[model samples]
Target chain A: MKTQSILLKQRPEKTPQNSDFEFKEEEVSTPKSNEVLLKSIYISVDPYLRGRMRDVESYIEPFQLNEPITSAIIAKVEKSEHENFKEGDYVLGHLAWKEYQVAKGENLRKVDPKQANLSAYLGILGMTGLTAYFGLTEIGAPKEGETVLVSGAAGAVGSTVGQIAKIYGCKTIGIAGSDEKIDLIKGKFNYDEGINYKTTDNMKEAISKAATNGIDVYYDNVGGEILDATLQNINRNGRVINCGAISQYNKDETATGPRVEGILIKKSVKMQGFTLQNDFGEKFNEGTKKLAQWLQEGKLNYEETIREGFEKVPQAFIDLFSGENKGKMVVKVAEE
Target chain B: MKTQSILLKQRPEKTPQNSDFEFKEEEVSTPKSNEVLLKSIYISVDPYLRGRMRDVESYIEPFQLNEPITSAIIAKVEKSEHENFKEGDYVLGHLAWKEYQVAKGENLRKVDPKQANLSAYLGILGMTGLTAYFGLTEIGAPKEGETVLVSGAAGAVGSTVGQIAKIYGCKTIGIAGSDEKIDLIKGKFNYDEGINYKTTDNMKEAISKAATNGIDVYYDNVGGEILDATLQNINRNGRVINCGAISQYNKDETATGPRVEGILIKKSVKMQGFTLQNDFGEKFNEGTKKLAQWLQEGKLNYEETIREGFEKVPQAFIDLFSGENKGKMVVKVAEE
Candidate 1:
C-alpha cells in the first residue's frame, strides 16, 4: 500500500512559507506481531509546532530537516495483532503526518467514538482541552470576583480559558485580533468584555478601561505588545500563564519589549511558562477528568474549525499564523 | 534644639542628583505624652529608594516634592515620656532624615547594642538580609547540587544570596561590575566562580563558560542586559528571582530587552518578583529566626560599608546608582 506524507523541507526564517513543507510518497509497511496498522483520521496543527521547527534546545526537540512532521492525530486501527487494540477501534496518539502508518498498539491510546465525536478527540476531549484546563487552573488559579484577561482570546486554548475563567466566577476580559473573534468570545464564551487588538490603538488604556478593577490573572497565549499592555493593568499578586507566544513564533530576529522585572517587582507578580507535555507530566488523567466533567455538564463548550482532506495539513497549519481559525484547528482525513 | 532635614526638592528625570534634595533647618519639638525625642544615629541608604523618588505609584507610596526623605534609621531616645522607651535607649523605625524628630514610641522597634552592632540592624539582621533570604529560599528554591548565579553579586542582597546558595550546597557563580568586587564575592563569599560583566565583551558566553552546565537558578538584582544574557543560559525548570533592578532604576525611560516568554516557556522557567514588605507579612519572624541562627553558628557573614556623618545621607543614596558602596550601604549619624 502507498501513502502521502508532508515533511519539513526547510526551516522557516520569519513567517512560515508553504515552501517550507514538501509532500512525499512512501510505501506503507505491514504490521508486525504486537503492532497495529493505523489509518490517520484527523490531524491537529498548533502554534507550538513553530517552536519545534527551529534548530534550538527546548523541552521538545526541534523537527529534523526533511523528516515527516508529527503532532496529535486521531487514527483508526485497520489490523491489530495486539491484545489491547482491535480492528475498527479509534485511537489517538502523537503520530506522523502519513495517511497510513504501522505502530505498536501500546504507543496509541484507545479512544471510544461513543465517548465523543472522533474529530473531538483531536480537540476538546484531548490535547486542546488539557492545555486549556491545566494552563488556566494550575497557573492562572482564577479566584471569584477577580478579573481574568486572556490574549489570543479566540484561538483553541484562549476560548477555553475565557470560559473556564467565567466558570470560576471571575470577570473575564479577552483580547483578540478581529472584531468577529471579540464578539464570539464575549457572546458565546461568556467573556464579560473583549478588545480587538487590530482595531484598538491603545491596548494598555483599552485593557485598563475594560478591566476597570484590574486584571488578577492573565492567560497569555499571544505574547508581544499585548502581554506588555496587560502588564500595565495587572493588579497586585497577579499570575501570568505563558502558554504560547504565537505572535513571536514567526519573527526572524528575537523581538524586544519593555523590561519586565521593574513591573514584576512593583506588582509582586508571577510569570510562569509551561508546555502541556513538559509541565503536565503525571497529571494528564486528572486534567482530562475535570475537562470532561465540565463538557458533560454543559458548563463547557468547544469549537473546531475542521478542514477536510489529508493533503491540506500543511496549509491548515499555515493558516494558524494568519488568525484564520476561530477555535480548535484540526484537519480531517478520513471517517472513523 | 535646632536640627537639619533633607526634603525632596524635585523629581529626578533620570539619575538622582544632589540638587533633587533640599536641606532645611527646623526646631526640634519637645516630647509630648507617649512621644519620644529621638536623635538619628544610623541611617540606611538602599537602591530601592530610587523607585520611591518617582511620582508614580508602586508597592510603596512615591515621594512628594518638599517632603522629608525617610528610610530605616536607628535613633537614640534623647527625651522620652513613653512607657516602652527611656532616655539613651536605641530604637529602629522608618524615620525621617532629620537629625532629631519626635515620634510615638509604639512606631519604633527597640534594639540592644549588646546583641549586635548598631548598623547590623539596618543590613544583616534587618531588611537586607531578609530580602536575600526570602527572595532565594521562597522563589529561587535552590536544591542541593544545582548551579546558582547571582547578578550584582557584590551588592548587599546579591552577596548574601551567593553565600546562602553556597550554604545550601549548590554551585555558585557571581557576576559583578568590577574585578575587585568579583574577587570579594568569590574569595570572601565562597562563590565557585566569578564573571566580571563590565570587562567581559559577551556576558552570555562568559556566563555559559563560568556556569559550565547551564544556570539552574538566577537571582537577579541588576536587571538589564545582564538579565537578557542570563536568560540565554538558563536550564530546564529554572527559577529567576527578580530582587531589584538597579541597572534600570535611574533610566529616564523604561528600558527594553529581549522578550523572555519564548525562552521561559522553552525552558519551563518561573520568573517571580517580590519585596520585603508586600510578600512578607507574618513571616518576618520565621526568616529572622533562620537568619539569626546562621549568624550565631558562624555559617553566615555580612559586609557593611559604613560612611560617617549626618549631612551625607543624600549623597550616599545618589552614590548607589554608580555602585559606590560594597555590601549594605549605611551612614553613621552620631556616636552611640
Candidate 2:
C-alpha cells in the first residue's frame, strides 16, 4: 500500500510558510501481529504543534527532521491482526498527517461512531475538550458569580473554556482577534461580553469594563499583550490557566512581555501551564465522560474549520497562526 | 506619655529614601479599659513593606500618605487592663513604628520569652518563619532528592526556604547578590551550592552547573533576570513559589522580561504567589508549632541584621532595598 504524509522540511523563523512542509509518498507493509492499520479520516491541527517543530525540548517531544508530524487523528481500522481492533472499526490514535498508518493496537483507542460524530473524536469529544475541562475546572476553578476572562476565545480550547465557565455560573468574557469571533463567542458560547482585540484601543480598559468585579479565572490561550492586560485586571487569588500561547508561537524575536512574578506577588495569582497529554493523563476517561454527557444533554457544542484532502494539512496548521479558523482546525484525510 | 514614631513623609517613586520618613514625638494617652501600652523592642523591616509604601493596590492595603508605617513588631507589655496580657509580658502585634503604642489587647499575641529568644519573635519564630514555611512546604512542595533553587538566599525568607528544603532531603542551591551572602548560604544554610548572581556573567550556565538535575522547586524572592534565568533551568512539572519580587521593588520603569507562559507550558511549571497574612492565616498555628519544634530540636537556625534605636528605622527600611541586610532586618526601639 502507498501512504501520503507531510514532513517538516525546514524550521521556519516566524510563522510557518508553505515551503516549510514537504509532501512525500511512501510504500507501507501490512500490519503484523498485535498491530492495526489506521486510515486517517480527520487529522487535528493545533497551536501546540508549533512548539514541536522548533527542535526545542517541551512537554511533547520535538518533531524529528524528515519524519512525518503526528497528532490526534480519527481513523478507520483497515486491517488488524489483533483481537482489540477489527477491519472497518473506527478508532482514534496519535497518527501521522497521512492517509494510512501502521500502528500498534495498544496505541489505538476504539471510538464508537454511535456515541458521537467520528470527527468529534478529534475535537470536543477528544483531547481538545479534555484540555478545556482540566485547564478550567482543575486549574482555573471558577466559582459561582465569579468572572472568567478567556483569551483567544474563539479557538478550540478557549470557546469550550468560556462555555464551561458559564456553566459554572461565572460571567464569561472573551477576547478574540476578529469581530466575527467576538459575535460567535457571545452568541454561541454564552459569553456575557466579548472584546475584539483587533479593534480595541485599550485591552486593559476593555477587560476592566467586562470584568467589573475583577477576573477570578483567566483562561489564557493567547499570550503577550493580552496576557499583560489580563494580569492587570485579575482579582486576588485569581487562577491563570496557561493552556496555550499562540500569539508567541511564531515570533522570531525573543519573547518579551510584562514581568509576571511581580503582578503575581501583588495579586497572589496562581498561574500554571500544562499540555493536555501529560497533566490530565489519568483523568482523560473522566473528562471524556463529562464532556460527552454535556454534549448529549445539549450543554456543549463545538465548531471545526476542516480542510479537505491530505495535502492541505500543512496549510490548515499554518492558518491557525493567522487566526483564520473559528474553532478547532482539522484536516480531513480520507472518507470514513 | 511621649511616643516617638516614624511617619511616611513622601511616597517613593522607586527605592525609598531616608527623607521619605519623618520622626515625630507625640503625646499618647494611657490605655483605658481593654487597651494595653506596648513598648517596641524588635521591629520587622521587610521588602514587602516597600510595596505597601507605594500608593497601589496589592495583597495588603497600601500605607496611607502620612500615616505611621506598621508591621510585625515584638514589644514589651508595659501596662494592661485585659486579663489576657500583663505588665512585663512579651507580645507580638501589628503595631506602628513607634517606641510606645497604646493598642487593644485583642490585637496582640503573647510570646513566651522562655520558649525562644525575645528577638526570635520578630523573625524565625514569627511571620518571616511562617512565610518561609507556607511558601515552601505548601507551594514549593520540594520532594526528596529534588533540586530546590532559592533566589535571595541570604534574606529572611530565602535562607529559611533553603534550610527547609534541606530538611526535606532535597539538594539546595542558593543564588544571591554578594560573595558574602553566597558564603553565608553555603556554610550556614547547608546549601549544596551557591551562585553569586552579581559575579556570574551567565546565570543560565551557573544554574545549569549547580542544578545538574535541573531545578524542581524555585523559591523566588528576587524576581527579574534571576527569574528569567531560573525559568530556563526548570525541570518538567517544576513548582515556582512566588514569595516576593524584591529586585523589581524599586524599578521606576515598567518591568519586562522573557515571557514566561511559553516556558511554563513547555515545562508544565506552576507559579503561585501569596502573602502570609491572607493565604496562611489559619495555618499559622500549625506552621508556628512545626517551626518552633524544629528550633527547639536544634535543627533550625536564623540570622538577624539588627539596627538599634528608633531613629534608625527609616534607614533600616532603606537598607532593605540596597540588599545590605543578610537575614531578617529588624529595628530595636528599646531595651528588652
Candidate 3:
C-alpha cells in the first residue's frame, strides 16, 4: 500500500513555516505475527509536538530529520496477526503521519465506536483528556469554592482544565486570544468568566475582576506575561500546574523571561512543570479510567478543530503555535 | 522605680546610624492585677527587625518614630501582682528595649534555668529556634540522604537549620561570610561542609562542590546572588524555604533581581517564603518544645554574640544588617 507521510525538512527558527515540512510517499508493509496494520483515521496535532521537532533534551526525544513525524492517532486495524486484535477493529496508538501503519498489537488499544465518537479517542478520551485530568486534580489540587485561572483556555488542555475545575465546584476563569474563543469558553466550555487578553490593556486588573476572591489554582498553558499576570493575583499557598508554555516555545531569547516572580515570595506559591510522560508508570491506568468515566457520564465536553487529509498534518501541528485551534487540533487521514 | 528605654528617633535611609535611636528614662508604673513587672536580662536583635524599621507592608507593623522599639526578650520578673508569676521567675516575652517592663502574668512563661542556660531562651529555645525548626521540618521537608544548603549559616536561625538537617540525616552545607564563621560551622556546628561566600569567586561552583549530590532543600536566609546560585544548582523538585532575605532588605531600588528563576521551571522547584509569625501558630509551640528537649539532651548547641548595656540594642540590631555577629546577636540589658 502507498502511504502519505509528512517529514521535517528543516529545523524551525521561531514560528514554523510550511516550507519546513515535506510530504512524501512511503510503501507500507504487511503485519507480522503479533503485529497489526492500521489505517490512520485521525491524527492529533498538539503544542507538545513542537518540542519534539527541536533537537533538545526534553521529556521525549526529538523527531529526527526526514523521518515521518509520529504522534497519538485514532485508527482502524485493517489487518491483524495478533491474538487480541482483529481486522476492522478501531484502536488508538502512537502512529506516524501516514495513511497506513504496521504497528505491534501491544502498542495499540481497542476502542468502541458505540461508547463515544471515534474522534473523541484523539482528544477528551485520550492523551489530551489524561493530561487535563491529572494536571488539575493531582498538581493544581483545586478545592471547593476556589478560583481557577487557566491560560490558553480555548485550547484543548486549557478548555478541559476549566471544565474540570467547574466539576470540582471551583470558579473557573479563562484567558484566550480571540473574542470568538472567549465566547466559546464562557458559553460552550462553561467557564464562569473569560478574558480576551489581546484586547485587555490591564491583564492584572482583568484577572482580579475574573477572580474576585483571588486565584487559588493556576493551570498555566501559555507562559510569559500571562503567567506573570496570574502570579500577581495568586492567593497564599496557591498551586501553579505548568502543563505547557506555548507562548515561549517559538520565541527568541528576549520573549522567554517571566517578570512577576516576586509574587512567589508574597504568596508562597508552588509552581510545578510536568509532562504526561512522567505519569506513565503504574498510576496511569487509574487516571485514564477516571477520565473515561467522566466522558461517559457527559460531565466532560471536547472539541476538535480537524483538517481533512494526511497532507495537512504538519500544517495542523503548526497551527497550535499560532493559536488557530479552538480545542484539540487533529488531522483526518482517512474516512472511518 | 525608674526605667530606661531606647526609642526609634528616626528611620534611616540605608544603613541605620546610632543617631536613629534616643535613650530616655521614665517612671515605672505599678503592675495592675494579673500583671508582672519584668527586668530584662537579654533582648534579641534579629534580621526581621530591619523590616520593622521600614514603613512597608510586611508580616509585622513598622515601629513608630520616637517610641520604644520592642522585640522578643528574656527577662526576670522583678515584681508581681498576679499568682501565675513570682519575683524570682525567669520568662520570655515580647518586651521593649527597656530595662524593665510591666506585662500581663499570662504573657510570661517560667523558664527552667537548670535545663539550659538562660541566654539560650533568646535563641535556641526562643523564636529563632522555632523559626528554624518549623521552616526546616514544615517547609524544607528534608529527607534522609538529601543535601541541605543553608545561607547565612553562622547566624542563629541558619546555625539551627544546619544542625537540624544533620539530625534528620541530611548532608548539610553551610554558607557564611567570614572564614572564622565558616570554620565555626564545620568545627562547632558539625556541618558536613562550609563555604565562605565572600572569598569565593564563583558561588555556583562553590555550591556545586559543597552540595555534590545537588541541593534538595535550601534554607534561604540570604536571598540575592546566593539564592540565584542555589537556584541554578538545585536538584529536581527541590524545596527552598525562604525564612529571610537579609541581603536585599537594606538595598535601595537598584538591587538586582534573581537571574536564575528559569531554573524553577527546569527543575520543577518549589520556593516558599514565610514569616514565623504567619505560619507558626500551632507549630511554634511544638517546635520550641522539641528544640528545648534537644538542648536539654545536649544534642543541639548554640552561641550568642552579646553586646553589653541596654543602650547597645539599636547598634546590635544595626550590626545584624552588616553581618557582624557570629551566632544569635543579643543585647545584654541586665544581669539575671
Q: lDDT by residue for model 3 over B220-318, one digit each (tens)?
A: 888877888887788877888887878777765345444233445545667777667666776677788789788777778788899999878888988
Task: Tell me which residue pairs clash in candidate 1.
Answer: none
Which candidate gets the maximum lDDT versus the true structure? 1
The ten-residue window of minimal lDDT in model 1 chain B covers: B248-257
Q: Model 2, which residues run further than 4 Å from truth?
A: none
Worst 10 residues of 3 chain A by lDDT: A253-262
TM-score, chain B, each candidate: 0.98, 0.98, 0.96
The per-model lDDT (C-alpha) reads 0.90, 0.89, 0.84
**In CAPRI terms, where does candidate 2 land?**
high
i-RMS of candidate 1: 0.9
Worst 10 residues of 2 chain A by lDDT: A250-259
Q: For each candidate, what TM-score against the reference?
A: 0.98, 0.98, 0.90
Residue A49 lDDT in candidate 3: 79
Question: Interface RMSD (Å), each candidate?
Answer: 0.9, 0.9, 4.0
lDDT of 1 at A141: 88
Give the range of the ten consecutive residues with the poorest summed lDDT in model 2 chain B.
Answer: B252-261
